[model samples]
Structures are given as C-alpha cells and as structure tokens.
Target: MTTVRAGGRLRPPDTRGAHRDAPLPAPPVSRRRGLSSSRVAGWGFLAPVVAYLCAFYLYPLYRNVDLSVRHYTVRSFVQGGAEFTGWDNFRQVLQDPSFGTALRNTMVFTLVSIVFQYAFGLALAVFFHRGFRLAPTLRALFLIPWLLPLIVSASTWSWMLNSESGVVNYALHLVGVGRVDWLTSPSWALTSVIIANIWIGIPFNLVILHSGLQNIPAELYEAAALDGANGRQQFWRITFPLLRPVSAITLLLGLIYTLKVFDLIWITTKGGPGDSSTTLATWSYRLGFGSLLPEFGRGAAVGNLLILIALAFGLVYVRVQRRQTT
Candidate 1:
C-alpha cells in the first residue's frame, strides 16, 4: 500500500487503480480576451455602414443646408467666398410668383396621389387576400408598375397620353369623345401627371397592405362569420380595425414619397405649360439646373422646404405611434 492524497487526508491507494493516474483538466479559456476580440469584430463590421451614412446622407444634407444659407453664384459656387445671406434665399423663394403655383400643385399632387394610391392599394390587397384562383399570379402582375424603372414608366405614359396619335385619345375617339391635350395644355398637365403618379404608387401600397393582412389571424374572420356578421360588417369590424396600423404607416410613406416626386413629372411634361404642373420638387430642380442661370441658393432653399415638410410629417408619425404604444 502507498500513501495518496484524498481531500487532504492520507489514505492508501487502491491496488486496482494504482497503474493509472488521472491528469488534471486543461485551464479554461480567458473570457475577457474572447469578449474583446468579438467586440473588435463587431466594430469592424459596423465601420463601413457608419462611414457610408456619413458620406452619402449626413454630408449631403449639411452641404444643402450650407448652400441654402449662402448666396452662391456660378463663379462663387465653383470658387469660394460666397455671401452669406441668411434667410434671404428663403424669403425670395416665398415671394416669387411661381412659388404659389408650385405650392398649390405640390399640395394637390401629394394629396391626390396618396388618397387614390391608398384606396386602390387597400382594395386590391383585400381582394387578393381572398386567395381566389390565379390571385397570386394577378398580384405579381400588378407589381409590374412598381418594378419598372421610373423613367420607363413616365415615358410609357407620355406615349400613351400623347394628344396626336396616342392610344388614350384613340380610345376616346372610338367613344366619340374629342382628343384632350394631356401634356401640353396648362389645364390638364397637372392632372395628367397626377394620374401617372397614382398608377405608379398603387402597387407599393398593395404590397405593404397585403403583408399586413397576412399577419391577421384567420380565426377572427371565421368567428365573425359564425356570429352572423355580413361581409361588410366583418370587414369593418375586424379587417379595418386590425389594418389601421399598417394603413397609417402606408399613408405616411406615400405622403413622403409623393411630396418629392420629380422624375415622372419632369420626364412626362417637364413641369411645363407655364408652371401649371410645376411642383416644389421640379421648381427646385429648375432653379438649380433646368435653366441657363442657376439660382443655387434659392434652389437649395426650396429643397430645404421640401425636407422640412417631410420631416414634419415624419415627426407626426412618430408621435402618433408613441401615443398608440403607450
């Protein structure tokens, strides 16, 4: 027998286990080192995103604000030492004759586009949620408008709505209605752009609203049906109430998007017919780049107004959401 240490007490070693000695376990890994390495890796992944936002978003916004405050001529824009006029640029923008027209058009275009887009989108989403035959295929087809490039869509509308040889006039002629000058006449130019914008926007609403509908439990509808609720009643009581959050967000997004719609209006009518179709967006572009003499300061001021409008609506949304949650 040989002495062995057991719990700090002397004991004789077992004869059967005397030939084998258990080795001590390896030391545990250092948690502090592992955590520090993981933190470094996380920062490495985040650096690119932070840099991109600073470069593209924050830097441009700062420059725009700077441009708005300073009276910069083409020479001064390229060179340095532009005069800082403070709110004079904004005042000029507000006092200009075209400002009223642009403001009115902006309001009409934004409100009309958002209302029709939401209405049509919500209708389509509800219809498609029924899951009828070929519904999936039809829903995908509706997304074509949203998927196409904005330029292509605008150009297509221009061709279709051409006064001389367009399909729309031809179709109207078949029904004995005279051809209406869509893009040219001041009276109809804004209306024409609004129609095109409405068409382009509906699909976005449909996709978002449909996703919201999917999250609603089907049992609620079944329960309503079992309670002798009619289709309209069920929709009003169950569907609409549940879809309120989605509708709010959809409308907010639509409002923001429609407010800055420049491409379609520009490509189709170039905001033409003597500022009839000109919105704040087109007006800003026209001031900055559309004309021979660019008013960079005034243009930046108008652009800032648009930004402020969007920001106001965004704040309202956040407040409303907070209230709902609380």
Candidate 2:
C-alpha cells in the first residue's frame, strides 16, 4: 500500500522478489534512419549495375537458351513456322564425324598453348625482374605482338611460315637445314598456329605475372637470403605462394582466350589439311556458316557446349579467388 501526500507521493510497494533502481534502456535505432550518406550512395550506385545485368546479361542468356531449343530458321522467320526441337540438334552434333576430331584438336591446342605461354611468360618475367639495363624497352617491345591487330598478325605469321619463300624457310636454308612445309602440312599446320597463339598470349601472361612479382616485398627476398636460401629455394618458398592468385588469374584468362581462338586458326589453316586442325569454334563455324547444309542447330549446340565449359572455368576461378581473399 502507498500513502499519497499533497506535494509528494509515496509509491506502491514492489511485488517483485527484488527492488532496485535501474537506468532507463535506450531506444531502439531505426536502421534506415541511421544509414550514412555513403551507404545510401553505394546502393544508389549499385542500382544501375543491377538494372543493366538484368536487362542485358540475364535477358540474353534466357534468349540463347530459348533459341537453342527452338527450330527457328531464316525461312521459318519469314513464314512464321518456327517450332521446338527436343535435343535433336544436340544428338546430330554428337553424331557428326568431325565432332570427335574437333574436340581433340581444341583440347590439344588449349593445353599446349597454355603450357608454353605460361612457361615462356614466366621465364621472361623472371628475367625482367632481375633488373636489366634495357628491360623496360624489351618489355615494351614484347607487348607489340599484343597490340597488333589479329588479322595483321595472322597474315604476317602466315607469310613468314610459307614454305617456299617465307623468312622461316630462308632462315632454315641459311642454317643448313632443309625447308619444311609449315602451313601446308597437316602435322605442321596446327603447330604453326599454336606458335602464333603462344606469341600473342605471352605478353598478357608476362604483364600479369610481372606486376605480381613487382608487388612482392623485397624484404621477403632479403630475409630468405639471410637464412641461406638460394634463388630457387626463395622462389619456391616465398615467391610462389604470393604469386598464386596472379598465376590462377592468368591461367584462367589464358585458357578462356585459348579455347575461343578462331581468327588466328582461320587465317593460318582455315581448319584445313583435311580438318586436321579443326577446333570446336572453327568446326561450329564450318558447320553453320561454311557448309552447304548449314546446320544451324548443330552449331548452336556446339556453342552451348563451349558456354558450359567457360562457365565451369569461371566457377573454378571464382572459388579460387574466394579462397585467396579469405
């Protein structure tokens, strides 16, 4: 019970087990009200990117999937007679005689090109990292191949590798070696294209890896030296670990670029010498565009397969990047 007075009041007795005075709790913060201008600006900036991806990437992907399933032709478009074909195109492409050969060639080309490109690029990067007097000039010179237009580079390489009067043959003659048919021969044509690809790819790898090497702290090398580690030991122990992320990025990009290589191959061999050098991309081109039959459906199927492979590689790259960041 409580007794009340005129100016001062006596409070009622507490029914609780214990009684104590506690400070009032703070009011809850409204998240939206509390957001900083920076956060608002960040979301505002992201809105356009979100809209663009939805409109461009997702819409096109959906359309490509739809197109792959449907039987839409040039005549069908004019006649309004498009229909859906259930996996028939994929079956036809799988059954094609050149499919196996094209797959093999593409795989071989990708593997060989990646190996040589990375190896040569790493070697060049290591050499440049040693601080040569003319390294900057040499680095700029190496980038010339990358800067050249694809058609120009392919044409130049083709002329140089020509068996009869090319510079390659002339050099061989000077070295007391017999002339070899570089582009005309089935065995040599693919190799020649691969060499050209390696040249184009080397600069890209070098740029990436050299930047990575430059980012490594000099103190690490100095410490390793103090611990009696040689150059090879220091590279494997310190340099390799730090360069892993860059190496992964370079490899993924190189593989993707090498997989889709077409212009060089087309200009060099045109998948010629009896389809010996026909890659998946070139094969798809030949089937849908180059052939009399013009199997558009089959070509679409091959393109879809390539897309899947690229997606898988992309997923792998994402996972690796995530792991590295963490």
Candidate 3:
C-alpha cells in the first residue's frame, strides 16, 4: 500500500497492488504451441482412418468413375491412354436389352430379400424373446446360413436346388409336386437367388432386431398386456413402433448388401441360362471380367448405377431419420 502524509490526517492507504505485484499475462506462444500440439495429436489419431478411406474407398470410387467415363480396353486400362467418352457408356448400357432385365432383377432381388429377411427375422426375434429352453441353441443354429462362407452357402443351395438330383426335388417328389427348375428357367432363376439371399440375411436381421427388442422397456409390454392386449396387439402397439429405427437401419443395410451381391449369384447360377438370373451385380462382373474381352466402361457404368441407387436409398433414410428426430 502507498502511504502519503496529509496535513491533518494520514491519507487512506492505497488498496490496489503495485504493477510489480500484478500477475503476468500467459505467454501466447506456449498456449498456441499447446493448441498446435493437440491438433497434431488429433490429426495423428485420425490419419490412419483417412488413409484407409483414401486407399480402400476413395481411390477405387475415383477409378470406377474414371472407368465409366472412358473407353478403356484391357490394354488401355493398364497403359493409360483411354479416351474419355463422357456418358457414352451409360447411354450404351441403357440402350442394351439386358439393362432392362438387369435393372428389374436387381430391384426384385433387393426388395424381396429385404422384405422376407426382415419379416422372418422379426418373427424369429419375437419367438425367441418369449424365451425357451433351447432358445440360445436354436438361435445359434439359425445363424448357420449367416456364419457360413458365401461360397459354401451358395454351393450348398446350388446342390439343393439342382434340377436333376436336388434334395428339394426329392422332397417335392415325396409330395405330389414334381421337379421344378429353380435356377434354370428365367421365372424361377431370380426367385431362387432371392430365396438364397433371404436365408443368408435372416440371421443378421434376427440378431439386430432382437437386440433392438431388448432395448424396448419390458414395462411397456407389461402395461399393454394388462390393458388386455393379446400377443399380436402387444407386438403391433409396443414392439413394432419401438423397433422402427432398428428396422430402418436393418433394411438399409440389407438393401446395400443385396444390391452388391455378386459372389453368391456368380457361384450358384453364373447369371446363366442367357442372363435369366442376371442382376446388375452379375451383369457388371460379366461386362467387366466374365469373358475374354471385358467391356470395362459399360461394366463400371452399371456399378455406378448400383452405387447411385444405394446412395439414393441412404439419403432417403437420412431424411426420414432427421424428420423423426425433429
């Protein structure tokens, strides 16, 4: 405190501290350095993910887009003198007769697979949610289709649906029904592939929907039951509404998976019997690498179409989700 003498009385002591007693401002350089280090550390942590996306996702997408717009023969694809064709490849694909069949087949395959997979999955989830002695065992058994390798499952289905000696035909013979060409005729071919896909996808839905069911409060169901709701009523009122978010995600994922399904179709039917069972996925592979002379541009265009379809569905889901949240 500063003391100054007055004529008659002592001046009041100064309460404020001197400049030397004041705290120093923090060094901005150090603060800036700290922020820089933190930012670097954050980016360091994110670098791997970014790199992975670039290498595995972004680069391939770029290449696919490039391929779709260029006239790339096998040699040109490798040696890099492909002429740009803009949308010519897309036009060619649209003009082809197979495009209509492939488009229709793709839609049918995706929608049918998603519908049956979700329905069967929800049913199984509900059934198991009731609990039983063999619930775990039964659920595990049901996952056999999902857990098996695609090749193995597709091959097994191929054998079971074989026109001549398939067990399906044998079982049908036990009844009054005769052998049906599951994979040969155009009418049955897409259905056969869809059936196989549904089997493969059901367990996934079951697992996800069951988990979602677990999240729904038991009290809700109990309250509904006490209100005289039967099983079906309780499911509709309590379960289905609560399960909508899960169902949306499951359906979206299934749509994406079923859209790009190539291995199973290729392994089972090879898009055979004259493009009868051909979906966009199989058709893309056929155009790109199915034979000696690959139509790289057209094939890439088909793949781009598939990507667009998936993207559209994804955008729709996001919009719906946003609306629900709001």
Q: lDDT for every model? A: 0.95, 0.87, 0.92
After aligning candidate 1 to the native by TM-score, how far in Å is the CA of 51 from where it should be?
A: 0.9
Q: Cα miss at 31, model 1 (Å)?
A: 3.0
As for candidate 2, its clashing pairs are none
For candidate 1, write residues 75-156 as lDDT tens digits: 9999979999999999999999999999999999999999999999999999999999999999999999999999999999
Determine which window of 10 residues in candidate 1 has minimal summed lDDT: 18-27
Which runs in model 3 stand beyond 4 Å of their true positions?
A: 1-34, 321-326
Q: In each prediction, how many residue pairs overlap at the backbone (N, C-alpha, C within less than 3 A)?
A: 0, 0, 0
lDDT for model 1: 0.95
Which parts of model 2 have CA positions greater than 4 angstroms off? 1-44, 47-56, 77-80
How far in Å is the alpha carbon of 176 misplaced in model 2?
2.4
Task: Please give the RMSD of candidate 2 to the true structure.
Answer: 5.0
Runs in model 1 with CA error above 4 Å?
Answer: 1-29, 321-326
- Candidate 3 lDDT over 1-326, as tens digits, reads 56678997779776567656988988799898999999999999999999999999999999999999999998998899999999999999999999998998888888989999999999999999988999999999999999999999999999999999999999999998988999887778888988999999999999999999999999988888888999989888889999999899889888877889999999888987788889998999999998899999999999999999988988987887787789
Task: Count clashing pairs, candidate 3.
Answer: 0
Window of ten residues with lowest summed lDDT in model 2 = 15-24
